[model samples]
Target: MRALTVKQPWADAIAHGEKRIENRTRPIPPKHLGTTILIHAGATEDFNALPADMVRAWPKDVRAVVALATLAGCHKAAKPRCCAPWGFPDTWHWELKDIRPIPHPPRPVRGQLGLWTVDDDTLAAVQRQISIERTSA
Candidate 1:
């Protein structure tokens, strides 16, 4: 599965369903639309940079694969809407759908910029985690 590395608090927010749109400087490629992607929380903690309310609602897990979401579409907006609070003007908003948190504990992995491929072993682990989440849900 493909994965996108997102920064700490925002990643956690996406995994927990508090945020549904991911803000980016560039638009996602057309091929990524309607595809499921892993949300990898990057290894950077900036709690002081986040809003106090968000800091208060931080997820227990970080710096790992926290969830899976469908990349529904991507759009550039002059004024932010779905992800306005977390987005800057003139950025692309990647709409997300069918967000699901991984039931198992977060698996640590190094993250890279833009969309990247997950290795076979990590993919298998993530698949297993998703399977468990499905059965339990």
Candidate 2:
């Protein structure tokens, strides 16, 4: 599976909050649509974007995989403020669905810029957690 490293509150929003749209400069590649990807929280936090109270509620798990989500679809922001507060003008809104948070993050690992591939060991660890999640559900 592939992974995408996102900034603090945004990543948390996808995992535990009600953020279904991820605003990016580019759209998700056609091939990756509908693929399940890991949501990794980068080391840096974007305090300027989200409110302080919202950020405080999110788990501070930097450089860690927070959730598994499906890259459901992508669409350009046709209007100035199309997708509510999360959407930005002139950016592609990558739709995320079926978000499943990893209760216990696997071993901490560095993140990359875009939709990067995860190593076999890291994939295995994430798989284990997903298995547990399924059985519990």
Candidate 3:
């Protein structure tokens, strides 16, 4: 499965279903739109970008796949502060849907810059978690 490496609190926010819009400097590729991808929390943290309360509450699960979400659509900000605190002006906002948090994260994997393909072992691990999540739900 494809995956995207996002920095700290932001990745945690997505996993918790608190943030649905991912701000990026580039538009989403047409091929990737509407596709479900893993949300990998990178090793870095954007502490100042989020409020202190949120930061303290969110898990800093770096280098791990925390959730799976569909890239529903992508659009420019169109206005200043478009998607509230999550969206920023002059950036493409990637809308996410069907966000399923992986309650049991797999082993840590190295992250990449953009959308990337997960190795067979990692993909298998994530798939197992998804199966468990579905069964329990």
Q: What Cα-based lDDT does every candidate model obtain?
A: 0.76, 0.83, 0.83
- What is the per-residue lDDT of model 2 for residues 1-137, given as tens digits with 9 covering 90 to 100? 78889988788888888888998999998888888888998888776677778777777688889999888899999764788877778999999888999987765878998899877788788887775232110
Instruction: Give the distance in Å from residue 30's predicted Cα in candidate 1 to where it truly belongs.
Output: 0.9
Q: Candidate 2, which segments miss by more than 4 Å at Cα?
A: 132-137
1-137: candidate 1 lDDT, tens digit per residue: 78899887778778864688788888988877778888998888676766777657557466688888888888886653445665566778888888888766456788888988877788788777665232110
Model 2 C-alpha lDDT versus the unseen true structure: 0.83
Worst 10 residues of 1 by lDDT: 128-137
What is the TM-score of each predicted model, taking all chains together? 0.83, 0.89, 0.89
How much is the lDDT of residue 130 in candidate 2? Answer: 76
Give each model's clash number.
Answer: 0, 0, 0
RMSD after CA superposition, every candidate: 4.1, 3.7, 3.9
| Candidate 1 pairs with clashing backbones | none
